[model samples]
Target chain A: MIPPRRRLRRPPSAPWTRRRPLPDRVRRRLPLLLVGVAALALGALAFSGIGDGMVYYRTPTELAGHDAGPAGRLRVGGLVLPHSVRAEGDALRFRLSDGVGTVEVLHRGEVPPVFREGQGAVAEGVLGPGGVFRSDRLMVKHSDEYRAAEPAR
Target chain B: MPHRDTCPHSAVAALAASAALVTGLVLAPADAVQGEAQRLMYVHVPAAWTAYTAFTVTAVSGLAVLARRGTVWDRVGRAAAELGAGMTALAVALGMIWGRPVWGVWWTWDPRLVATLAMLLAFLTCLAVRRWHGDAARGARGAAVAGVAGFAMVPVTHFSVLWWRTLHQPPSVLRPPGDVPVDPPMLAALAAGVLAFTLLGCLVVARRVRALDAAAAAPAEHVSRAALGRAA
Candidate 1:
């Protein structure tokens, strides 16, 4: 008694179908993908230019033609000028040059004992009070290339 | 008394939201040191926590989609990743603004900070993979794999303080150390941040899932509409 079109009915939820099963290779590899995403993201962020505070070492020769601003904080890489390292109570003094423009640094902190003239060091801080570069921290520069130094403990 | 499905809103979610709100806004105390400036911590800590939670969810969902070969987990995974990333990005920006004035630096390569930034990038990559990969099934599977691999950063992020003596401090409010402890005021603020965002995360995920369903159903709907038009 009912028309064929009317009687040909599908269940409401049956309209949706589950397609092909995911390949076995993908199933086995999902964990690896997740882990990869986490690592790449972390590594890129760690070394990004987003934080401009940290710096790469540069020599006085490199800074010869450079302009040093009063409020700027950056690493000045150079050999400490001979006999230029001095300390007055709280302020420590040093000079760095790329053999062109020698910049004097006055730091208001304890100077590392190794901070002496002709030493390879980078002063990390701001320039202040008359073209004087003031450093809050200093790092000793060491080359990572392994050299054949005489065997010693 | 029974299921409240008849109501369009989720009562459980609503109640949870209310509780979280009280904790974030009223209970958390102002930092003895930073004072009002410390207020940023409420949203901050929560954003990071929620970001971690969201990424974890993606990993699980990615796995599910791969194993079951269905659209269910794929949709869930993408939704969680996007939402997680949105809040985490917000957290990093807020943290930077807070740090500039206090720490005198806009950013640092501190281990924990580095790890969190990495986590954000990983989530973005997963989303990118999903968008660009061509085949539906293959793309979902590929992204799923990436999601799982990306999770390796989780432990690294959490333990960054222990592993490195970086500038960033370890968990202070959450970790047990301060004599004052987290006062009720501070706790309340943190709770609110968590609640608001968790609900927000769920809300976004649900809406996304529904959208995916509608999009999936569109072809059939279109055919039906055409057929109906012909009949008329």
Candidate 2:
């Protein structure tokens, strides 16, 4: 015959058997409380530095107004001015415009294949003497607008 | 169990996804500016949209779990979190692949990119919380809370482009009351892709919820069998 079954027992000191300092409902809701607090803290942090967090790149007009100082590196985004691109030995020079102000850029690195006049581009570097923006890196910025290779039938 | 032998939803999802692939890769004309790289948008945008839908489902199901105290809603919240995290990862990877050629860098610290990453992490944390405690009910409760809180990331990520200057472009389709910027053929392809992905995501979530229910039932079945043996 099978032995009679017995319910499992826990020692008095076992964590589950120990007396709880907090009420059951409060203990159950602690995780939710923690999550709420964390979310609020993160929101606070994000909002406190929101100005810097939001602006990914400075436009030509914005950059012109600020004194970034010598040796300060920043990214300037604007449209490549038509007929402003010229080659100087290994480097390429182009004027970036934002319809309000324009900044001449001297990019020393390889120009992206998509880099073309009338298209948006962002250059990362510092301002040099004679009001020229010296760029070490260049990136093409395509607009949200998309068109077929040929006009839609 | 009646539908267990064959899942019609999976089959339909497969067909829809195949049609999307063909239309996106073949029928849609190459972009005038970005060329074939633009095709990545077909998958990238749909994946992001699917992720957003999944997170929203999780958030709603999480609320149900809190109010009703049932395992069904808990399972749904978990399943949705799983799909949301996976789709978020897919969107990010595809965006990186597209960005490498278009933006000249594989990654950047742009607001849109950072917000998307944070959204991915939030859902992943929700999934992890489900398995944190040994007690199923307690774990589900914690995960439900996480699911509700994590949804805050969705709107932040979606609007990051509009709220700030971003390397990423603004919305082409889900914009203000105006004509969509995408060409007709490209728009068709993208719409098809979104439909396919949404169907597929729903199918996966349904299957996952069923599996979780079965797993939850198994231990009770085993206990009953052992008790029957003792009675015999």
Candidate 3:
């Protein structure tokens, strides 16, 4: 005959018998609590300085104030000043302006087919001596406005 | 498969999608500035809009699941999330293709681009959470919470262009009053595209919900059949 099992129970006043610190409802919501904490952290990061970093490129006016350390590659975006685009040998030179300031850009590459004067463009390179931007890559930036292409003049 | 009654919505979606393709490709004129590359906007913008709508549905369904504690809402949320993720991926790819020729680069670290990518990752993580846990209730609840939280990325992505100075342009149609700068024909085509994509998204979500429900019931049916055989 198998021995009868003895029941062991903790005293009512024992620490083990005390209620859990967190209620069952709160315990069940732990995952949600973690998510809330994470979202808060991300929001904090975005608002504090990271938001400023999100600006992909700087305008001519901002670039004027920016002091990129020596040899720092920076991107400057603005409207290409009309009649400022001229080719000299293998290099093309133009001035980018945002109406507040202008930066001279020297690019040595095949310009994009869509690049036009008085249109928005971004150039990526370092600033040379005398405030000239030496760009190796040039990109056109289209505006939000859209219209039918006019017939060839 | 969806029930026979849902076939009418599917048919209408198909017809609208066809109309959108015709109008977007053949009828809409090339942009004055970007020329033919602007044509991609019809599909790209619509895909983005559809993704936003799908994610909104997921977020709402998630709230319903949390409030009601029902499998129906969970299934709907999961299906919408899956559809939203796919549309987001499509929009990103189309944007990249458009970017290469027009923007002169395939990708950039622009705020709008980064925020959109973050939104995609957030929903994908929510979907993954649904499969991570062994307990069905726990997994579903966790996913519901995640789905609700992931919606914060949508507004961030939408407003990133406006709040920051990025290479990406600001809103064209969804802006404040008196600022819709698109051509009339182009706007019409774009409107048609958005409608077609939205209807198609709804049809797909409905079918997916039904499929999920059927799959959830299959194991119980199998168990019942086995029990009956044993009794016999």
Candidate 4:
């Protein structure tokens, strides 16, 4: 007669019995945890120095005392000084004034048709060593009032 | 196949969108700086907002797909991404048209514009990868990773105007600090536009997801039927 197989007894203190499910659970969740951590890290890094790069729009008066670096570009909006605009070849020179301060502008492109003396305009460029604002682009600021006022003129 | 289930929000979305068009095109006053051309903002801003919303949906759904390994989430993610990419392209094109009249140029190396273009390209690539891959699961997993990783560009795009020397205008209505620079009426019109666009995007995505579900199920049903017939 074959000897009956000895019954295998489970050890209550065995590490494998206690830890098996935990590892399987951890393995299943590890990818998700990794993705979350990576995204969080990337977000933090991307926004870290955002303030330093933020370039706010300012009027001539507001931009008068501010010194962004030579390469720094900013926008100044205000009325174009009457008779302050002059064109030489392709370059245009003008002054933008906000009633309190006047910033000189030197542009090297075709000025927009709507841009005129005594009209509202915004200039975007870098500030030179002097008080001059060297602009590469000029935009005319036309309001509904300006359009309504145009037909009358 | 004819779609039997109609989107419940379709009528509401259509009504809201029509109202937004009227408010934006007729009721809203022209901008002081950009004049009539500024009207493009009504469409452009809303489109951009919708794109952002869609991409967020894509990312979330993508994450769900990976975690659950469900076809439902994968289809939702794909639909959202496709819609988001299209909206982003529309916004970019509208922006260019507006820029031509206001900024006096058709295009510029503005950081905001560049970032937005990059986002559009990245999402389009994600969709392409999903389409071309032969293995469904592998393709979906790859797309999910792309959808999630590509979101890193969204914050950058939104903040580029503030963070970089850009020709693009700064936030007027959405500024978080201080006061809203835009007039109340203008802000109201913009809000309406955003609402309409968001609702429209949701409707489209919902319909697309349902279609995808039907398509995915049909093949499985056919295969099961064929197996049963062979057994008989």
Candidate 5:
């Protein structure tokens, strides 16, 4: 042990040299390339994926049958469970369940005024530490006309 | 050592990547059937759509320049032509990445793929025209003609899907008589992808025009300055 420790203390010899500063042209090019790469990465992360892979939309029944893995972004689709929507200020919480299974969705965005329980809507985002689907983009799908219209009085 | 805006392509690249990210991560819907893997469609489809947009812009601009005569048309034609080319390259790249899983090939000579490849070669011909010609005024005119001729490839790419049986699925946006009804999330994602690409194309063209205008004014600066001095 003592001998090994002594050997470890003796640094492994290797040739090394300090590098000179980069010229202006090279210096300029590097940052431009770096920014380009970073932008690509950011786009990939924010939109496409952040390593784990891009989130996939599925019905609660499908999610119930499949392995979403831990920390995966999940797009859960199905009817907004009847009377399951409850809210506290901007946090609109509801349960979305296919006929067979259900997942709680916690979202902070404005609920489309026309969004009511038991309608076809899709909420997108990642799975939280708990089982809740944390949605960031919500679109309440209406029949042929997706754009929300004034509710009849 | 940092250059302004990093690299020459940084600005547009950042915008494209971020717009893609927003469409992919934030705006796009995940597939109801495929789940996370469906996210790939956002980039793949948009890349293809943007390529379409670029070619359309280039073709129209080239036609305008050929029909009329001005630096404005030349500039527009050039910017659109270059953008169309870049988008085509991006489309192919994203398509290959998506196809590996769904189609089992990195590339296919399928009608859609082949037509897109032709679109790319068409724009490249425009670049070639520019390279071969020396005088700015005459070069712009020559390149405009080439751009318009090359753009005929667009209709070829567009109809390739319907005209030939290929590995690629028929369009989901509007199905043929027997086309399956796509899941709601998929339609949403597709719409978002189109919108995002349109925004990106507009941003790219704007930047290209500004950069070109600055470049064009550079060579004739001494002449313009002397003219201004004489007038004064």
Candidate 6:
């Protein structure tokens, strides 16, 4: 049988202390409070940046009619006119129209397979003095519907 | 028998899953513009929605874990965070795949895309906190703190499409009041997909929590057995 004295010995663990490391109020709630404030601040910063950073999508008519200074690049979205799409080597030239007006786009890149005449597309670049929209990038946009209405031929 | 109670919604999830697949692939008419590539919406939207739901669960459970330290809360928080991270990764992948055929490029520095990617990384960092700590006791609290804090990314990700001009399209199904952006049938299908993914995510989290509970218990049992042997 184990000796009584030996059996009663404490295990090799840190001695139990009644004193708390910090007050109950400050100890439990402070970290969470700080985190919440920090998140709010960060959120405020992110939300504020959205206004000036946003690049609004525009159409040909809006682009031509806007008094907004040509501060930076903008996107013009519409359909490539039928028989207006032509490619010379890698350079592509097309006319995008939203029925009210059309813009000439000169792009040099591989177009999406879905990109074709009379399909919805967006061209991103600046409008030069000669009325040509020099686009470095082109994207095809589509309606979320399962079946979109046929484009007017 | 008790395990059966853990995930009571799996059957519903399976049903919804099948319905989504059928509606998305077979029943829905091919998109007049994108042809069949637009079918990716069925998967991408559902996965992203599920990720948002899972991360919210993670944040709530994280608060619980912080309020009252318990194995159940820890398990749930950890599992939800893991599932959220996985779903976010899959959503990003599906978006990229869809982008290639529709957008003509594999990727862009679009705000929404970048924000989603950042959110994914934040959750991953939460997971690493749970995994990399040398002491499991301390790690749980750290992970809970991180999980709760990381939730700030959710709103940012949700609003990124609207806040910036991106290569990505703006919200359609979840848009402000107007004519429904998608056809009625397509909306129904997308709803089915979201429901299926949410239920599936819940089922996955439940199983993971159960496994974590079992694992946590095993070590304690071993320590008790060793103590008992010493006493004997």
lDDT tens digits, residue span B173-224, model 5: 5434663455444556566666767775766666566566655566543443
True contacts kept of 6: 0.36
Which ten-residue region of model 6 chain A has the weakest summed lDDT? A1-10
DockQ for each candidate? 0.05, 0.25, 0.22, 0.06, 0.01, 0.19
lDDT, model 6: 0.73
TM-score of each: 0.58, 0.82, 0.81, 0.67, 0.51, 0.72
Restricted to chain B, the TM-score per model reads: 0.81, 0.91, 0.93, 0.90, 0.79, 0.90
Interface RMSD of each: 17.2, 7.4, 8.8, 13.0, 18.9, 9.6
How far residue B195's Cα lies from its native spot in candidate 2, in Å, is 0.6
lDDT of each: 0.63, 0.81, 0.80, 0.72, 0.62, 0.73
- Clash totals for all candidate models: 38, 0, 0, 4, 10, 0
The collision pairs in model 3 are none
Candidate 5 regions with alpha-carbon error over 4 angstroms: A1-153, B1-23, B26-35, B174-180, B220-232
Predicted model with the maximum lDDT = 2
Task: Give the alpha carbon lDDT tens digit for every residue of B49-124 in model 6.
Answer: 9888888988888888889866688888888888998999899999999999988877665678768876776676
Cα lDDT for residue A109, model 3?
A: 80
Q: Write the per-residue lDDT of candidate 4 for residues B1-232, one digit (tens) a residue.
A: 2233543576778888998988888877776555777778889999998888888988998899889867788989998997999999999999989878876777655567777877886677667656334457877888888899887778888888777655576666655677666665567678899999999898777777766666566654244334323322
Which portions of model 3 miss their true places by more than 4 Å?
A: A1-54, A66-71, A151-153, B220-232
Chain A alone, model 1, TM-score?
Answer: 0.54
In candidate 5, position A25 carries an lDDT of 43
Chain B TM-score, structure 2:
0.91
What lDDT does model 1 reach?
Answer: 0.63
